[model samples]
Target: MEPNRTRLIGEYIVGPRIGSGSFAVVWRARHRQLGIEVAVKEIDKKLLSPKVSDNLLKEISILSTISHPNIIRFFEAIETREKIYLVLEYCDGGDLAAYIHKHGKVSEAVARHFMRQLGISIFTFWLFIFDQISSAGLQVLQEKHLIHRDLKPQNLLVSTNEVTPVLKIGDFGFARSLTPQDLADTLCGSPLYMAPEIIQNHKYDAKADLWSVGAILFQLVTGKPPFDGSNQLQLFQNILTSTELRFPPGAIEELHPDCVDLCRCLLRQNPVERITFKEFFNHRFLGELR
Candidate 1:
C-alpha cells in the first residue's frame, strides 16, 4: 500500500528520509553502480492537490533545461502513473538557514564571499560568460527577464570548507514564470525578508529580490532581521512601512560605509528607485566587480 518503500526509481535506492514538506518527501539515496550520493524527492501521489505535482514537474523541466553553477544541478527525474521521482545532487552542508541559525550571524567578509560565489553562478547564464563561476547572478537573471521571487538566506547553499564560503541558490519550488497574470495581486514568500510592495499586495517584479537581499544582508550584519513581531499583522506592518530597520551605528562601525549605503539603495520602497542589477554590479560595495 505504501508502494515500494525499500526500492528506488532506477539505480538510486531510497534511504533515510531527509525532509518532508506538505507536498513531498526528501530522502538520502545512493546510486547502485556509480556509488554516488543523491537526494531523492518523491511527490505523494495521494495528496497531489493544487497542482503541486504539476509544479514539481515544471521545476524539473526547467532545472533540466538550464545549467548554471549557482543553480541546483538536476540529476534525473522519473514519472509514473502512481508517483514522481526527482533525484538531485547532495549538498553536504545543507541550507544556509541551518548555518545561520547555528552561528548567530555571518561575518562581513563571509557575506561578501557568499555574494561573490552567487555572482559566479550566473556566469554561465545566456548573457553571462559560460564556464565561469564568479560572475554576478542578478545580472544574468535580469537579462533573462526572470525574477527570483523567493530570495532568502535559507535558499542559499554553501559547498566549501573555507572560512569565507562558496555558495549557490537552491529550491525552485516557489518560483513562477513571469506572465501577464503576474502583473496583478499575489503576494508570496517568507514574511521576515519580504519587501514593502509584496506586503501591501502591490505589483512587484525583480526588484522584490533586491529588498530580500537587503534583509538578508541586515541579518548578516546585525544578527537579526529588520523587523520582529509575534503576530503576522504586526510583522507585515513593520515590513510594509517601518523604516527603523536602518543599520545600528555600532554595527556599521564594523564594516565599510559603502556596504550600508548599498543595502539602503536596494531596500528602497519605490521599486523604480531600488538599485538595478547593473548599478549594484558597479557599486563601490562591489569594488572588485567594478
Candidate 2:
C-alpha cells in the first residue's frame, strides 16, 4: 500500500513527493512541532535488492558522520520492517543542473563564485574522511582517498534559506572510500562526467573525481558537455580517444584564459598527469577569485 500524504513518518509530516529514483522516493516534509522543512527519502526494503539495500545503508552511514557547511546535512534516519526514511536538509532552490538549464550557462563571475565553493567542498570532504585515518597513526597513502564517484551538476544542490543560494554537494549513493593502493573498477556515474580511465574499465583512484569536476566546469561555461554522441557506446569511444576539447567559436573568448587552462589540466586522459587537488586549489583560476 502507498503511504499517506499526511501521514507522520517519525517526527516529520509527509507532504507531496518531491523526487524519485530507481530505489527510493523523496518527499517534502515538515517537522511536526519545529515546523522546519526537510526532504525525507523513503526506501521500500521490499522493493530493493539486497545489494542495493546494503549500499543505501552505507550511504546513510557516510552522511550521518559528515558535517560540513558545503555538504548536504543529514538530520536523521528511521527504519521500519518494510521501509527506511532519511531526513535531509531541504534545499528549496533545487540543483545546479536545473539552474544551468534555465540560465544557459552562467557568467564567469557566477561560475567563479560557484567553482570556489565547489573546490573548497571537495577538498574539505577528503579532509574529513582522512582525519580518522590519520588519527589512528596509519600511513596516508595519497592526498585524497574518499571519492564521490557520481560528481555532477545534478548531485549539487543550492540552499534557498540564504540571501544568495549556497551550493552544497549532495547524494552519497555512489560515494566510496578507497586508498592509493586500492583502485575502483566499478563503471558507475553519468557517461558525460566520467573520466576516460573509468570508461576504459581501468583501476581509478580519487583523480577520477577531479576529471568529473572538469566536465562540470566546462558545462558551466559552455552550456554543454565536452563530448557528445548519439549513444553511450559512441560517447565512451569519444572519451577514450579525444585528446582535446574545443569550445564553440565565441565561447573561449567569453571565459578567462586561466579558467580554460584549468579545465584542460583536469580533463587530461592520463590520470597520472591530471592536476592534484592541491594544485587545482592553488590554480590561477581559483586564485584569481581571492
Candidate 3:
C-alpha cells in the first residue's frame, strides 16, 4: 500500500524475503536516492492488535534512540495501513544463528575473534560488561531505563565479512522502559532462555537478560540448547527449577577460565548472585583489554 513511499524508502527493488520472524520480514533493498543498499524490515500490521501495535512502536522508539557501531542503525519508520517499514543498515552476512547452523560449533579462533570485536563495541557503547553480554549491554540501557524483554541468538545480526557480527539485538516487541520503582511481572522471551524468576511470574528487571545471555553463551560453545521439552509448560518448569549448569566436557579448556566463570556467574539462579557489569568488566575472561 505504501508503494508511493518506495521511492523514499529505497532504490534497490524489493526482492524475495531474505529473512522473517513471527512479526516481520526483512528484504534486501537499495536506496532510491543514494542508490545505496539497505534492508527494509516490513512489519505486518494485521499480525498485531492495538496493544501489540503500541509495543511495536515502542521498539521503534527505542531503536531510534540508540546509536552504536555494533548495533544495526535504524534509519526511519514508514507506515501504511498494511505495513510498517523500518529502514535499517544492511548486513550481508545474515544472523549468527544461521552462521552457526551452517557451520556447526564455531572454531575457537572464530568465537574469540567475534567476542573481542563485540567487547570493543560493547565497551564503546555502554563501556561496561554486566553478568552477560546483553546484561552488560543492559547496564547502559538501564541507566537510560530501557529494558529489552527479549534477547536471543536469532536477535543478533552478523556481517558477511565477519569483521564483526554487529550484534544487532532485534525484536523489542516486549521491551519496556523502567523506573527505580518499576517491577516487571510479565514472562517473555524464548522459554529456553527465560530466567527462573521470570518463569515464576515474579517481579524482575533487565537483569533477566543475564540469564538469556548465559543460555546463549552455552549454546555458542556446545551447539545445543540447554533446555527443551515436549510442551510449553514443561519448558517453563525446566527453566524455572532446573539446577544443573552443565557445559560440554573440555569445552572450557580452549576458552579462558574467566570466560567459564563469567558464564557461570551470569547463569546463576539467584538474580542477586548474578555478576554486575562493573564486576564483569574487571573479569579476566574478557581479556585485559582495559
Candidate 4:
C-alpha cells in the first residue's frame, strides 16, 4: 500500500509524484487550508539499512538546526510506522545537474554567478558550526565541522526568481559534522566529483568538498567533467594519475585567468596544497561577487 498516493499526510494533500530514488519518492503536495505548495519526500523505513538509517537521522538533525538562504529549507517531518515524510520548500527550477545538461555549459559570468552562491552556502555552514562551537566553549573539539562529503551539481537545487535563480545546497545524506583534523575515512560520494583522498581510501576532511566544488566549476565552464573513463576503475586511475588540470583548448581563452587559477588551486591532488574554504570564499574569481 503506497502511503502518500492519493492521500493526505497530516494537513498536506499529496498530489502527483515529482521525483524518486531507490528508497524514497518525492511528491508534489499542497496544504489543505493555505493551499501552499511543498515537496514531500516519502521514505520507506523498511528499506533502510542501519548505516542509512543513521545518515537519515543525521540529515534531519543538521537540517532542523541550520537556516541559510543558500541551503534547502526544511519545513517539517511527518513520520508513521512505515514511512517518513519530509515536507520541504518547493523549488520549481530543478537541480543544477539538470540545468547544466539542458544549457550545456555557461558563460564565465554565469559560472561565476553560480559559484558565488555555492561558495556562500558552504562558507555559511562553516560559520554556523563555528559559532555553535564557540558559544559552547568547545573550541578544542576539532570534530565539529559539517562536511558535505558529496558536493555535486545534482545536490544543488535552483529556486526560480524573476531576476536571477537562487542555488540552494540539498541532499545531506553524506554530510557529517567533522572537521579536517578529524580525518574521517569513510569512502563516499560520486566518482567524477569525489576528491582523490576519498578514492584512495585515505582519511579526508572538509577540504574534499572544495575539490568537488572545483570539479563542478570545471564542468560549468567546459561542458564536461575534468576527467572521464569507461568504468570506475579507469576513472579513479585517471583522477589519481593526472598531473595537470587542463582546460579545453578554446575554453581557456574565453575565461578569466582568475577562474582557471581557482580551479587549479581547488583541484590540486594533495589536499594540503588545495585552497581552504577561507581562501576559496575570498578568491578573485568570486571576490567581485562578494
**TM-score per candidate, in order?**
0.86, 0.88, 0.84, 0.89
Please report how far candidate 2 places residue 59 from its true position, in Å: 0.8
After superposition of all CA atoms, the RMSD between model 4 and the true structure is 4.9
Off by over 4 Å in 3: 1-12, 107-139, 161-164, 252-255
Number of backbone-clashing residue pairs for each candidate, in the order shown: 5, 0, 8, 0
lDDT for predicted candidate 2 compared with the true structure: 0.80
For residues 180-254, write the lDDT of model 1, one tens digit per residue. Answer: 235524677789888888888888877787788878777876788877778989888766676544666588788
Span of ten consecutive residues with least summed lDDT in model 4: 133-142
lDDT tens per residue, model 4, 150-188: 888888888873224777788888888884558889999
Candidate 2's displacement at residue 197, Å, is: 0.7
lDDT of each: 0.71, 0.80, 0.70, 0.82
At residue 130, what lDDT does model 1 achieve? 48
Residues 1-290 of candidate 3: C-alpha lDDT, one tens digit per residue: 46444444434566557888777888888765577777898989889889778988898888888766556778888888788998888878888778778767765456554554333324343443453333224455656777777777777777674634545566677889887578798867778788888888889976787677667766776676667778989887766676867677777676667667777887888888887655655556556553
* Model 1: residues with Cα > 4 Å off, grouped in runs: 1-6, 119-134, 160-162, 179-184
The model with the greatest lDDT is 4
Clashes of 3: 8
Q: Using alpha carbons, what is the TM-score of model 3?
A: 0.84
Sorted by TM-score (best first), the order is 4, 2, 1, 3
Compared with the true structure, the alpha-carbon lDDT of candidate 3 equals 0.70
